[model samples]
Target: MRGYPGRFDPLIYYGKLRLNQTIITKRLTPIKVDRGSRSATATLPRIQPRIIGATYLMIALLADIGGTKSQLALMNEQGAFIHRRTVLNHEHPSFDALVDQFLHTQPPPQCAILAVAGPVDDGIRCRMTNLNWLIDGVALQQRLQLKFVNLLNDLQATAWSMTDPGVQSRLGMLRGSGLNFEQPVVVISPGTGLGQACIQPHQDQYVIQGTEGGHKTIAPFNRLSAELILQHWQQYDYPPSWENWFSGSGFSRLFQTMFPGAPVPDNATMGQQAISDPDSSSARCMELFTQAIYAEAGNLVLQYLAWGGVIVAGGIPPKLGKLFCQPEHIAYIERKNEYLDRLSAVPVALCQEADAPLTGAATYCKQRWHESS
Candidate 1:
């Protein structure tokens, strides 16, 4: 994996691919206005700033900001992955501290596009749901001396990566009658949290958009499942959302709910036990987690009309691919639709690759760089 050629030239390799750069730049453009002087007359662009150095080597920094771990990579303008590293969020007290450590060991890039785990405002301020940190885009750019900086939702990064060749290596192929590039694609990932995004054709290019659909109220198909979720929520006073059932920690909650009196181990301990002993209760928890994930995937497919198909990419699904591939799990997915004839026609697949987010981020940055250059 370390020896792989990571970068590509869009002009040489993807000139005919019809890449979408307009949405990215338009979304990332800074809103011009005075910071302290709120008067309309003072809204003009600041005039005294001197010009910076010309023709700095264009490099892209891609970061995956997840709940448990954050992965960062540096790619050159030519699309080659030059450096890659991962850091545990638990080890850092703040987001700035993590960035400081990352930059201390590896130099900052010219341009940076980070896939954060939450929504990004126009000014680039973001708040990760599972992690305790506030990310300020303007501050980060000024501190790192970056020419360009853009922030995207992590699921959107996964969606953009679907078009890359590297993603093909990790995506399991499924042939279905209705699957086509012209149709929308839905991506549902289950990890520390449940994430959803959609990719749709926008004019000559595709737009990958994020949705907080995971937090939507989960309507159970069966009375037993409904009662179980409701009871768990009632007992814990937690919201009855898809993330409460589809995520890794959600598994432990569900398991404890089901077993009631069984000893509940923490996520790391449970993972270790599950790996060492497949027959442990930890494994059972994972099995149930996969079931909920499949159910959510089916829901997203119907809601999005993802005829381009559904792709499951996350730390959880890929780790438990074999468990997800079981007959019962597959049956559960197929059983959700009364319109089986129509649903069976749609392609459903899993993404087993680890570096999909990184690849997607690289692709996004390269496209933007080409458009601006």
Candidate 2:
């Protein structure tokens, strides 16, 4: 069956008062209001707040669609997620089928916000980078009778994740301190591929700009890094990119580059070995990966003028743990002679929340829904 029987126009209930569209609350916490001033403030009680005119609440389907897995959830305007679930991409026959199954027992979402692991071509359709699936926003909007559907580059979603306090709480400072939110912020995520995005403050909201910085020409931070580039160039018949030595595939690729004749383990196993066995080749590979990450982050910080901060997200960094907190990692970022002070002053943080992308999608959806309302 089609996931929905008819168009969904969410109905909201707040105690005895029934609102038409929006549910306004901060982090799902009860909101208190000054009825005379017609303003709201965060409070502890679940008192019924006066809403002006029709309330504008929308329940959105949020999906972090990646090559290996997809995290699906329904997020209300209060920024609370319900029924979050992760499903293997391959286990489902198609993305549409996967969404249908996920929504099988739930009411159809009013809108859908999808974060996809690929470039959003024409701001609508996306062809998965490492999979055969294709996500089309317009098609989904029609099929589900949704108000709107938006596709974001996965990195764009990760950048927006900072809007959620749940994500902010898990952020571990790798280096530097103090955050200046007035300036731009950047996010670099290395998983199946390298992703980059920047968040620019606009009035009271934020504008997320996706970047293809990962595909930029590679610059060797050191001699060994230079040698790997040559190795990749010789074998692949093209100059290497930052993603070559910076992403999840970097583990296996680095292992192969170091030991030409040895069979390389899978990326996960190599990452574990890097953490557990310091003297092994895996650790050495991780070392290079760490340096590349720092080096590129420095470049991005300078390029974006991201004094707000640089957030390092994705599946790989969290697994590296304190391995990334080493001072040597920041050394790569601070190698800039003139800008060392500026780069050093910018806080570099590690995002530990695995559901960061989903949170981001929810934030994006909520913002768009408000705009529409």
Candidate 3:
């Protein structure tokens, strides 16, 4: 990727022209036909990075790691998928083993971006909340012999996915038109865990900030909801969180609390049963679950001051899409006493695309590749 005079240079990777510097950038090669000594010492100028395409070049390793499974892919600077692989987390002893198997026959990527289901420290280290895996980006880069590596919270990766052009078509709008859309949107995902990320749309781009907002104490809208929270607290002797009341485990706990003697089906099955029998206990529980999710999303909108909107995304939303999109439930999301009008005005959409974090990791990688040092 060689840059020309008076043109965009993002595609071209460059190393600084320094005097007697020993540093070497990846994908750089030099050759000399002769013992070529024009002066007292040999000298070199900046070198162009290896290019694969006319404009969109840079290939990178992108990964989306979750509690139950993981997805890895090779993506280009233009956000095109070259190849992807999915693996169960439990099947592999560690992240290193899984990544090694995936990259066995693949070219060593210049950069790697990993989205883990946990809190990342300084975008480098993460201790997975559901799985027993501690990932360190710097350590991974050394082991893989890559030039750069970045780690992101899985939800943050999902937030980044929204930036991909293809994702817009997969979105299902639930509320306001795009007219009121603004900066600082928030994503609320309920699945294996309640994942949240605040996306601040900047000038022609967006920035994602991962948060553990799911662990924040649950806020009830009324006395019945307050009672439900109390019962949830009693189960663990700790205050209930959005994760405790709205995630996969949350649905199970709520169903069990409602029906102690009857069989408790999996969350997916429960959703099916609710759809089949709207008057059953499963339906009541689903109503509670969906309503709780809406409330929490509103709470997040307020917490983050996200006037842009709310994107409800996760494994569960698409499954319960029928119940999730009920217009009657919109009130639950706009119940804020003081900010009711503002909350209602914000656009709300449910992202239907699967494997969002992979696309997001690609978006993050391409951004990093283009904005060179």
Candidate 4:
């Protein structure tokens, strides 16, 4: 793909100002930091001196590309965050356009790791499931003339962030049960669409496997849910997949079915109503939505035997933190027929930090180039 025509302009600044660049900087657009998570502006500890060698100043560029927006960050090999920027996906015609925009305004990094919202094939090609875009790491690397480019499934990137100190510090316990690090870790994120991934510990490192589990038909937990599934089935040839009822579109569908007489609003409008008015019909829809999600979370835990833990990530879950972490929801998730005890032992937690996927992409870059630094 051809990059948008532009000369490198140093005047336009899109990202956060560097720590050393300005004493008091103003953000062009404020990023809403998650209240439950540690502040991004927290004072960083001093970096230790390297023995008999100068510290590498080379930075790695990281990108978390999703359906709605793309978050980009710059960090040193030492894993210190330098700056970040957010670009709405619609702002660029293609993925290449977005990358070109960033590259034009900033000095190119040694390498880049991009966490995209679809499976990265063996050839490093990913056709975004929710957006009309194709991303090929090899092609992008050649076009940018970067030393290296790594592609990771967005959920795979979120999975990797579990090991990041910043992510770990922000995790608030939903289910207080202890986690067995020896077992596999699974992350289920429901955003514009549903995404599920599992990370298993290998000999010395972890292996992340992104799953199309979201496309699998979901078995209803109750008679009403079963009927709803049937309704969804009647409307489409395909079976009611997890994604059909667990994402933003899912929320809209549920709201429509429950209140057919009312004007069917979009997912964003419904979400605002639910969050603002507890007694509203939207809130009732959210209650059912919460139940369905909890049931699915339990199924994932059992399906993968993810005793290492179950992490609920994405834009939705963390926003409904109060609803997600309710004791009743955990109780519902833990209600497997014979495996209730097994499920109970698997900790369920909300990923408070929204930058988790971006951070995870940075982690991959850090691992690959830390020794060089």
What's the TM-score of every candidate structure?
A: 0.74, 0.83, 0.82, 0.78
Write the residue-wise lDDT of candidate 4 on 114-207 in tens digits. Answer: 9988878873789997899999888887877666788888888888887666676778778765444577878888877787888787765667
Q: Is candidate 1 or candidate 4 better by lDDT?
A: 4
Pull out the clashing pairs in model 2: 21-56, 21-57, 22-55, 22-56, 22-57
Local accuracy by lDDT, each model: 0.69, 0.78, 0.77, 0.73
Once fitted onto the true fold, the runs of candidate 1 whose alpha carbons sit more than 4 angstroms away are 1-57, 88-108, 174-179, 233-239, 268-284
Better of 1 and 3 by lDDT: 3
lDDT for position 252 in model 4? 66
Clashing residue pairs for model 3: none
Q: What ranking emerges by TM-score with the best candidate at the front? A: 2, 3, 4, 1
Model 3 stretches astray by more than 4 angstroms = 1-57, 179-181, 232-237, 260-262
Which regions in candidate 4 have their CA more than 4 angstroms from the true location?
A: 1-57, 234-236, 275-279, 370-373
What TM-score should be assigned to candidate 2?
0.83
User: Which digits, one per residue and each the tens of the lDDT, describe model 3 over residues 1-373?
Assistant: 2332111223333633221223335443353423346423322333444232332235688999988899999875446777788899999898888888998986566688999888899998999888898888999988866668999988899999887767866777888765222478889998888898888877767778788888898888756678877776677777877787678878877777667668888877888998899998889888888888888888888888988888999889888888888987867878777888888888888998788888888888878776652
- Ranking the candidates on lDDT from highest down gives 2, 3, 4, 1
For residues 53-138, what per-residue lDDT tens digits would candidate 1 score against the true structure?
32113457788888788998877545766678899999999877887777675645777788888877873788987788888878
What's the lDDT of the predicted structure labeled candidate 2? 0.78
- The alpha-carbon lDDT assigned to residue 65 of candidate 2 equals 92
